[model samples]
Target: MFLADAGVPTVSWNLLADLQEMWAYPFMVNAFRAGAIVSVVCAVVGWFMVLRRQTFAGHTLSVAAFPGASLAILLGVSTSLGYFGFCVAAALLIAALGRKGRDAGAEESAVTGTVQAFALASGYLFISLYKGLLEGPTALLFGSFLGITTGQVTLLAIVGAVLLAVLALIGRPLLFATVDPEVAAGRGVPVRLLSTVFLVLLGAATAEASQITGTLLVFALMVIPAATAQQLTARPGRSLALAVLIGFASCWLGLIAAYYQPYPLGFFVTTIAFTGYVLAHLGRAVHDALGRSRPRGRTPLSIGGAA
Candidate 1:
């Protein structure tokens, strides 16, 4: 009868109304706030992580967070503390080992793999020690929206602020080092110190991002948006800003979709971000192909990221 009435709005209108109702709940409100914070933090740190080709390191840190949160459950301590502690510790270890490793690229992969394996083992051990309680680690691994509290939102904001500040202090030198470490070192930039500092920042960022995206889905928020933005632009400033926009949109939209649907938030977030990346890649490929017919030779891709 309600559907038959002329006064009744369409399904789209019902969806809009439901969205408003979604905000009425405190948990949903907190989830949105937390998602925004996580998106921004992940975008900034992740932009640099991708630029430096340290995606493996970032993945290792995310894996490391699993054990940290699990251990916290075992000890009945705050999971955030465990997350930050283990991630930072892993970052330091990776940094230290990278310096001593024979081939920089190959060693980074080996070290990251080793760390990831150990972390997963420790996580399983802790989860097993937790007796019959499964929800704590499950939330850390898969994410939970309704469990997000106002205090967690505030903490994410504060951590995000500190991370951004530190990045601002080191961004220029870090970028130079990332682009050409030997040249940056010749120009008097402390390449090694900056590498260590950046790794720590990456760890913190991974931990913060995991709160929203979960450890397994951290790449959705941290890498996919940043990578997509980089693919679309060579200018560093535009790329960073675009990454933040993409991440925020993905996170927010994912949250909204998860609210209305019966599926997982991480799945929606990953799907949305991945879809954007694939579209960008296809558009760029098509554009290049069309441009190539005008010239006898293939058009060259831009290798250097412009300031």
Candidate 2:
């Protein structure tokens, strides 16, 4: 068949040969799955991240994960495991430290920033301590989908499912807490605990995402989609759903572009995500303009973006 002739195996003989061939490879299949699962989790967690104004936490946990990854490489273990372990530890530390003060302000974030810097420096130092320590040592921090294995894909699936469940179980309470912490506390919503839980999940999500996009570009996976959706729709549920869709689209498209283009995969994904955010902003502007030129007291489509 055409697919076989084009070096791709497909159930349909007449399918696009080159594209089918790409999927015939296990590595490609694993990369696609891992990237997809991680993208969804990141998008979901990122919604709260934006609402709670905790993008800094996302950034903090990612860099703090570096030391664990570096140590994993030196100790002959999976970098993902190392990264997860380290971030969890840091999350616990942050929670404890932040709880000590009555007023949680820039001070907590400043401490997180300092920890992040220390972790990054430690990672670099560990890497430099040994020669030929890795095949592509930097890939742990920067990401390389080309290197994903089936086992890693399975691991991502498990982690993604667990994270999604946790997010769903606490979604409503978290939303309430994020929008109005004082009210949530007054209503006995365990505001502090909720905040800590969110931060922990965010750290885990960041570690998973960083494996594909690197620590530097994890924000694309975490922040951009939710942010774009918020700009387009004002409602929490709608924005969250749209953010997931946008994040998924960006992942698949970025993967394809990375497959074909010479640039790093993260670059393509980041560009697409940024573009989506921009378009959303523009769409908001147009909506405002049309509303202004309408009848008095016109009912605008509730920006809530939900059905």
**RMSD to truth, every model:** 7.1, 6.3
Superposed on all Cα atoms, model 1 deviates from the true structure by an RMSD in Å of 7.1
**What C-alpha lDDT do the candidate models reach, one value each?**
0.88, 0.82
- Residues 186-255, candidate 1: write the lDDT tens digits: 8999988999999999999999888777899999999999999999999999999999999999999998
TM-score to true structure, per model: 0.90, 0.88
Q: Distance (Å) between predicted and true CA of 159, model 1?
A: 0.5
Top lDDT hit: 1
The runs of at least 3 residues in candidate 2 whose Cα sits more than 4 Å from the true structure, single-residue gaps closed, are 1-15, 99-102, 133-137, 295-307
Residue 214, candidate 2: alpha-carbon lDDT: 81
**lDDT score of model 1?**
0.88
Please report the TM-score between candidate 2 and the true structure: 0.88
